[model samples]
Target: MNPFELEAAVKAAADGDASAFAQLIEAERTQMLRVAGYYVRNHIDAEDAVQEAICRAFTALPTLREPKYFRTWLTRIVINTSMSLLERSRKTIPTGGAEAEYLTASHKDTDGTLDLLQAVSALPPKVRRVILLKYMHDLRLKDIAELLELPLGTVKTYQNKGLNLLRTYYREEIEERRRAVEPIAADSAAWEGKDMESELSEMLHRSRERAKTLFENQSAVASAELKPFIEDVFRHGDQVRELLFIWTKPGTEIGISVTLSPDGDLIDYSVDMELYTEQEKCLHLPPEELFAIGERFVRDHYPDAPDQFSALEIEDRGDRVFFSCSQYASGMPLPRSGFWIDLHRSGFVTAFKYFGSKPEPVMPDHILTPEELLEEVAKDLSMKLYFMRLHESVHSQGDDRLHLVYMPQPYLINRPAVPESGESKKNAQAKDDYDPCAGANEPILEVLRRNEPGVPADPETLLESLGISEAEYEVLREVDMGSERGVVYRRREAVPAAEAVDSTDPYTLYRYMQARNEETVKVRFDRDSGRISSFIDFREETGILQLDDRACLEIALNLLHTADPFVFPHLRLNLEEEEDKETEQPSRQNAGFNFSVCKDSVPGFSHHVSVSVNRTTGRINHYMSADLGMEELEKLSLVPSLPLEEAKRRLIAALEPRLIWELDYSDDRSGDGHYMLRYKLVERESGLSVRMIEAHTGQIVTDNF
Candidate 1:
């Protein structure tokens, strides 16, 4: 629908026109499902969330301030509803049995589809939500921020972090598969005492010979209308023991290579064919001219080539040029489907090889509208949340409190509790005095109550008095209290005074207060809600032992295990960097050890754990770790709700054609402009949006344009 039509419909819907409301809902249904699926694991739940959102939107339509923002408004409602459902059902949702059965019945597996599904499924909910909205729905980063009510920076972080996680996981999986097959392959006679290069050469030779015969027998050029004959014997090499033969006709040429082993046995061979050539050598051809040459070559040789081959790229190799082009459908490049044309310095086409099969036109027996396809897509959507540790620099004396913003996309309600009115000033003035021998057995709240006025009732008692459910809050107890000496407590406003706190505030501070012998405690509780946010304990040691990198790593790993028991097996020490320069006295220096979570010890995963230790003292100074909270993810099913092929078809069906101005730079330094036709899938009313869908996984691919 055009912008005017959509705006009119939205206006009518807001005016209490039921049919118009339905029309708006129907138009945006598929998009809504794509967004909702990012929060919920199954289509059933996604549908439930979207259904609830629709009901809520209809009831609140009259309050919509802008008709043009109808899609964004409805999307926000869906996100909220989906998150609410996920939060409520996180603990009790059953795993893969019934869902697996349904998936098995509805979907047939395709290449890389299952792996892509698993990788995405394992991402954290917030990261997954960003991935879906940005890639699956083709929403711009800014649009995603607006939809999820997040900062644009945060959305970008999620995208990068999520993709890094996916890449790491995929690499690990590939390594595992390679490891699994290595033992068997190593024991085979064909591999025993043979170099890999030699084995590959032999295999390629056999494959190429077969390919040559097949081409000669069945290729279009082999027909009687075009009789080609051997024209030349290219340079034969003795070092490689390879022979090259060239065949030519009026408008076509073919080259073949045959390699032999030391024993004169066949090793490998390759065939290259060309349909166009230029006899004159042009030392420097403009990029436009190069592009024109490629275009003309393809049109003359392969006139029936599909529309997917429109995207092109030209690489200048100084001695020659290589043109690599791919076919695109629905704003995405088709996998492995295109041609590679090599142009020599003489401007003659040297080779043309169709690297992938021609894509069959997708013509579904019945075409589903966007609304109908939304139902199908809902069945395939999955949601997951990952935990990422973002570093924020602060003065050592600034507030140590971790302030979390509640993002609806990930469905985390981490709002800082607002201090009660009229009490902010009093709370701000309260000071915490550090006593190494302060009350050990009493609750910290009780200690606070004894030390200060205006301390509300005991936290548990206050919650009980307020009739709040204990289960609503998850108390993270025994967090670390970093090593910092001095007055541990400071009375400050429990609420943050601004969106961002000034670093130089006199009262802003982070310190350690003794809770018991050899121990310190830092407690964070919502002053307004009377619920605990986190409680961390630090143990103080009197003696320091000399240690090395290995010992430090062992201690760091132990601490990591204590912090998160599940990550121990997957964690591997990735890097150990020295933080201080060597001295003549050989005194110990601080060192940082970084650990990454790998599936089977394969590297390249993001660093999840960082431990800082006093290398001379053998004491761990500080450490931090992040994960996708996989324990929660493990409880949910990994089975997709929809089939891969069906999802692709549905995505394609929902795509809307758009005109885009593509630029072709001139090869000469003149900087002349050339325009070409290109198609993009864009969100309605968005500014020059170009949406790309991954052909294999049916996910959107975001690009810088």
Candidate 2:
């Protein structure tokens, strides 16, 4: 299927279309099993591992943010699942295989492909993963890094090691066969028929089912594969178990630490739960200190108490603190007006927040002096940040920082909890019994012989071969329903561009928003420097805009169907017009970019936002909430860990009279940003919002007109 169809199928699966998902999975299971068997040497274990991975992938289906990475994501999950299975295994499996059509026409040629497959199947699990990825898929080092979430250097290392092992193994195997048939060696010309590369490729592409079938039929199957499964599954399980525990249990082992400025002042503090391992050994703060420390910490140490103070989950170890804040929820949106703090163990803090100004009905129990906030979270940040800096020292220069992140095995400090006593003894007994991860120094050739498949294509060529339908492709176009067209068509040379003036509401409240409506929001943001320099968009609209005594709420959704929003060769947007809305001028101009904007208003609360557009995708790349001051921030104790919907509800309660406008400036390089219009609704009050346009273009530097 083409990308669009795949995306739609993914979306359907996310929405609970079990059948569609099953079909997609069934179509790819053959490949999935091959890959799984390569990473996991035991055929039975490999089968079990792939099934488990598929189930997890299906359950967490919605978490997939990008459809294009589907295969890669699935590959990672399968690898992870196999590793997990290995960890939990007590005894390792001994061998594996992939299917081959043993029939050759006229029985004339003994398939060389089988020989090639045998060599690959012989390599170690780790080395095999690299080989299959490199040869079977022919992906570059960097792409493999993204797929596996491993470093490019590490991938390269595996590639080199695996190839060298294969070369050494293939030579030894050839010699053994030659010794038995000395005539072939004497007539070396006849033996030139053994093609090592072809055989290896076939092995990498071998079917897992075939490998399994071979193992079941064999008299003695090795047990090494099971050992790896035991090792990996338990290791993986432990990490997952810890995260869930931290998320569900409160104050199980809370601890915090702080780094004092030589001047003994606070710079930044973070709240984390991975610090203190033993709650019993953790520092226990005397009650009196909690109340008393408030004065000096906020009033004297951070005179900017109301401003610079930060409060988060802090491991309250009497003197040696640990980390975290009850970010589960904020009570209110504190006006950027006053200072508020809280003092409590995790459960209290997690259920409610205060740094973003939460409720402090009872000062002693809930609220703390500004000083208390600083004392709590700084310790946690210091520890986590210190480790981060150390890692940075090692890999900081590897790549550009503007769009990529380089984090090594996210800061792991809390020692993994020992499995309960009984399970530990049981696992020990199991460990003494099996050896599955290693199937011997299995000749790379024999392993490959078991799994190799028939037809093969290069990475790019294969995707083309799957080919999706054109009709489905059309539904994938990028759309912008927010065009301020009245000014363009009615007032310009051709037709009326704007929808009939929003009789109910129109206009933007933020002064900066005028830039979106006027097509003059010049934005210059440098990723490396982290700066928003300028943004602009201008449009002339001829319609009655009745916006007063009200606020507006508008949302514009740009449906994207292509990887390159511009020059999208396969798709186009379809817009349905409403009779109630004003007649619009149909033109070749805004046909590609379709926009949708909605507006409404409320009473007493003041809020407004404006967005800009600069590319064919015409999507709002970022949004700066209009009134995100400390007062409101402090009340956002509910913001930290809430689902997006819960966060929105809390925001609505806290920031009532607010306006947020968003526009898409996908590419400044193409002044084509000009023809794109993002729609919007400006609200002045609780129930008041004006429908309008925030067309932004011509603010970017592009090589072409």
Candidate 3:
């Protein structure tokens, strides 16, 4: 119905018109059922909740303060009815009233299904109430504050805490499932002759048992000073969890919240912003008055803030003025541990954020002077040429084609590597074999050992090598890649019939068990040629380590030669010295190798093959190689028009040194991090930070507007 008709119907319904009330409520029945389903979870219970809400709304229709809010009023009644029904079904007797038990008497859940409602119901009572009102019922923060008779800040704080708890719960559930499946896959001997369905059912049964006392196990840890603020907030989980203490006047969004660590030490304290009201936030107060208000709030909360912190700068953001403060050590600022207080123009502190921890930084023995920093930046910075396609918006006067351009380097200064003397810095760079342009030479194309086409190999033999049985596996064909075809073999298992049952009783049924993937071996090949392109083993590996980098490379090379013997001589191991210097060594768990087939070593015209092996089994876990035809690579340009020396000169001429403070987070064995003042290079005049440099013309361009 249109707004006018709805308004008229609401008026008539409120004036004791039964027909109008029926018509109005009938129009909203579908929406009411959906909202009810969010709480009650099943269709039957949802319909029952909606019916009960219709009766309650009809009795209280005349009491609604505004006729325009008829839908909202009815929705609130539906939410309450659904919660009441859900509570009764869960065998939890709610306070305030006793009503006719419908589902409680007849419904008996045989399977536990932990849906979204079950997760929310597992939360602390106060937090659960706020989450239901805010999300399930779609109530505004302002409306919720008024209905609950609690501060707006408190509701918002509860909302954030509820979200964090839900995220942690879901993450734990995923990890638990992964742990459950890995044992079944890795230990075949122990699980021999066992039914997979029975094992999964037992795991789910334990999870459901834990869900019964999930809320009671978790307890929030807070200081005595913070206890008064968090008395209404609910706590969950076995370990002490983070608690947020917030206080605000009813109806106003302006309030304060303090976050405390598990040890009751201060993590952060901040004032909540007052955003909903249309009134001007500025009081036209002078800078002195604003500073005083902020200082007072900081001092009252933290008595030692004046002695330990120093005011950094003042920012006037029109609505609120902010006073930035930071901890100082060795006459330099510690950026991480600090507080920022913002005030409304009326000289009242609108927001305050403080960090109380003190960090002990490993102080630099010798600081770099401005001249030394600039000299180091000039020596380290160099231009690298790239071919980039600019967006049409960025190239208003030019066509959208690839352009070559030179961009400056050294955006980040590795503070720990900065030397105390220029001689030491030069020696260190030489010893480490540092190359500024090392990142530009990454392999663009991967090619397999076979360049010549041959007869397709038997898939049965490959499956036997991976310890997979053809009798228990079935092939899945997909044509999503257009020209390329994909074939996946999934292991078959019997699905439990009882698992499909959705039971709403929280105390009786097993919580919802999300679908789990049993490890399936997959192999993909060219459809026409029948030559295998990629193979992956999805099963978990658990055994003694055997293969290292050299062993893995030997296995990869032999596999490539077996696939295509003719092109095996042309493929070269593509590991570069620059790669070793820049990248960390691969872990022992999985060793990877790459081999490339280049056309006269031309950029973007070469193909590479990458193979990764499981160290424990000494078998290839993943094998991937590009299948680009040789005819395609022969069409691209092989050489560049610009010389290397000219590009270098242009890059050096455009470079300008910029000094900055850098933080070093690496542990230097002394258990303290370090900070250094250094210089980096940027574009000279306009300072446009575009990375794309036109190769032939030596001009800078951007891919973004």
lDDT of 1 by residue, 561-664 (tens): 44445554445544211211111111234445555553322221122455656556565554444322435334433334445556445444544444333322
Choose 2 or 3, whichever is better by TM-score.
3
Residues 1-705, candidate 2: write the lDDT tens digits: 323335555655543344346545644554455545544443434555776677657644544555544654575567556545543331222111111111011111122224655767876665677677655654434445545655443465465455545545545454444344443332332233234224423432242223233223322212212110000110121011000001111222122212122222332221222332345224445545643444333454345543433353233433332222221213322222133333333211111112223233211233333233223212211100000011111121212111111111211111111222354323222211111111222222232345333322332232122121232212211212111001110112222212222322211111112212222111222233222211122222223332211111111111111111221111111122232112222210111122111111110011112232222222332221121122332232221232333322322222112212111112222111111111111122333221111111101110010
The positional error of residue 309 in candidate 3, measured at the CA in angstroms, is 6.7
Q: Return the TM-score for candidate 2, rounded to 2 decimals.
A: 0.17
Number of the top candidate by TM-score? 3
lDDT per residue, candidate 3, 322-409, as tens digits?
A: 6777767666666445777666676655445565556555555666664565556456655443333333433322353434444434
TM-score of each: 0.23, 0.17, 0.38
Cα RMSD to native, each candidate?
27.7, 30.9, 24.0
Candidate order (lDDT): 3, 1, 2
lDDT of 2 at 434: 12
